[model samples]
Target: MIGETLSEDVLSQLKTILPKYGLEDTELKIIQSYRDSSQLNQQSGFSFQNEAGSKIQEEKIHLLENELRILKDKDHLAQSVAKEINVLFPSVDSFSLGDFLVQNVQDFSSSKEVTVLVKWKHQVGSVERKRLELF
Candidate 1:
């Protein structure tokens, strides 16, 4: 498992097991980081379904952000734990899922009102369409 990377779905489910290993605080921190990252991501052009998904996204971003911060610290134990986290959630280092939130952006010239268009892409038959939009 250390040589091969973990998939997103697997990482998501495996995250639950970290707590059993007494890494709950570390995991929570990572979730908080992802939440913070998600807030910035919300500024991007995309939409979320219901408040629950939005809330969950925020929490995940926050957790990821906190974990990154803690990992950056010089604590030896924290560093070791961070390595374990990397092994579990391989996607975290690959791309910021938060970036998916802000793939597109539009601005109004007169009002100076920044409209954030959030859309979720879905597959319809043979084509993919953005089904949800939010500003």
Candidate 2:
């Protein structure tokens, strides 16, 4: 039972759950170790879908989903900022706002005063940093 493999159904359920938890390939190996040690496949009527119905798991899933939504919102904001920068700095040939990495962000007492330190590579293989202000 210990060395036995999980059925396709269980494996499929695991694949769905693992990604929702942000588990990567390395973490999957740890899960495999636990699965092998626990011999979950040998248990009668053991279902990951059923286990996922637990309150704690549901709460964790909800939290992770919220985090993902926030991250997506931030990414959209970044893209919008990039587009705006591209329009504003049209004179800089070969300059892509998306290529700029955010080094630092500072906010002043006034909402209009926002400063961002961005770093990007120049066409001549040099890194350049610029402090941009938003008013």
Candidate 3:
């Protein structure tokens, strides 16, 4: 489901969930708040009656879980174009632009394997260097 878009139905449904912990809002107002945007983007925001806030929180958790799963899968493999680029590249000085790669499939042993041709640009002080790694 990578890159999958949330359906409008899911969005609308998410827009309607009340904070389970806002139990102090009196059961009546809290219940009514469901399917109601009357409380969002207002002073009564979150911690109480915000709808979008809850959905966003849930979506963030979902994305993090997916990322962890992808990382685990990567660990189970030997070679991959998937690098830990997001882990902050160790640049020497002020700026570093790196880990650019073109994806391709290479046929090996009658099977196709994913290959990457990576180009990295590193800059230290006024000196800039470019390196390529193919695997």
Provide the clashing-pair count of each candidate structure: 29, 0, 0
| Comparing 1 and 2 on TM-score, the stronger one | 2
**Candidate 3, pairs of clashing residues:** none
Please report the candidate that would top TM-score against the real structure: 2
For model 2, the local distance difference test gives 0.52
Task: Estimate the TM-score of every prediction.
Answer: 0.21, 0.36, 0.27
1 or 3, which is superior by TM-score? 3
Model 3 regions more than 4 Å off: 1-49, 79-135
- Tens digits of per-residue lDDT for model 3, 5-45: 56667655555553554544434322233344454435345
Ranking by lDDT: 2, 1, 3
Candidate 2, residues 23-134, lDDT tens digits: the string is: 7453433133343423654444345556546877889999999989976776787778777766765433332222233344464322322234344334322222232333
TM-score pick, better of 2 and 3: 2
